[model samples]
Target: MRSFHVSKPRVITVDKNPAYPVAIQQLKQKKKIPEGIQIRQVKYLNNIVEQDHRFIKKRVRSMLGFKSFDTATSILSGVEAMHMIKKEQIDLRD
Candidate 1:
């Protein structure tokens, strides 16, 4: 939340996690978040964030199984690097 640049957000979308609203209330009391900022706990609203992971999930689902944690980490790192390159967020030549 600190990474976001909004001075005063009208609404904040969050999942149905119990701690989320409590955290928001704490922030509101501390003047971190606007007093009237709406905390939306809609379950389906989180699909927006999950949508980006679909591609990675699809690829992972096709794999038989990772040999170990290290293997999974290495493969995921490569997948992410490829994604970054395809999105032009990172230069592959670098």
Candidate 2:
């Protein structure tokens, strides 16, 4: 979150229910966050990320396990980089 140059970010978190107050309080003290930047809380919107993780985990499980740390890293890095690149392409197309 801090890596992105987004202020007043609308955070969409997921759990059985929304518990955004704790997260908002924690963010309040962070020096990097600017004042007056509203932090909006959203719940049950993280299913997409969770679903994506499920596919990646399935791929890992299919391998029985990673043979080496580097191989695992390479696979995941490629997956993430490709996902980002493709997402940007889609956004541009829109």
Candidate 3:
């Protein structure tokens, strides 16, 4: 996962997950990130993603459970589309 923080209106700090470490390591070793870019080894910051799981659980509960995988998938597909449409209206700016 990649995270970008905006300090000012323009300044950005991008933190890429280093769980594997190889990608960042290679980028640094090959100088792909360039000089003056600070690459700090950080602990896993998975709280945001973890917190979102509760919503999935809530959605599941809202469905009242499915008897079969196909039924679950069908319900999920429709629910996901509805959710996307609702969210896109709020998120997508023309």
Error of 2 at 11 (Å): 4.8
Candidate with best lDDT: 1
- Spell out the clash pairs found in candidate 3: none
Model 2 residue 72 CA deviation in Å: 1.3
The global Cα lDDT (0 to 1) of model 3 is 0.58
lDDT of 1: 0.81
- Which has the higher lDDT value, candidate number 2 or candidate number 3? 2
Candidate 1: segments with Cα more than 4 A from true spot: 1-39, 46-48
Q: Residue 65 deviation, candidate 2, in Å?
A: 1.8
Per-residue accuracy of model 2 over 1-94 as CA lDDT, tens digit each: 5566755544534444445556656766786544555644445455666566765787778888888989999999887777777667435453
Worst 10 residues of 2 by lDDT: 9-18
What order do you get sorting by TM-score, best first? 1, 2, 3
RMSD of each: 4.9, 5.7, 8.4
What candidate 3 gets wrong by more than 4 Å, as runs, is: 1-55, 89-94
lDDT of candidate model 2 versus the reference: 0.64
Model 2 residue 10 lDDT score: 48
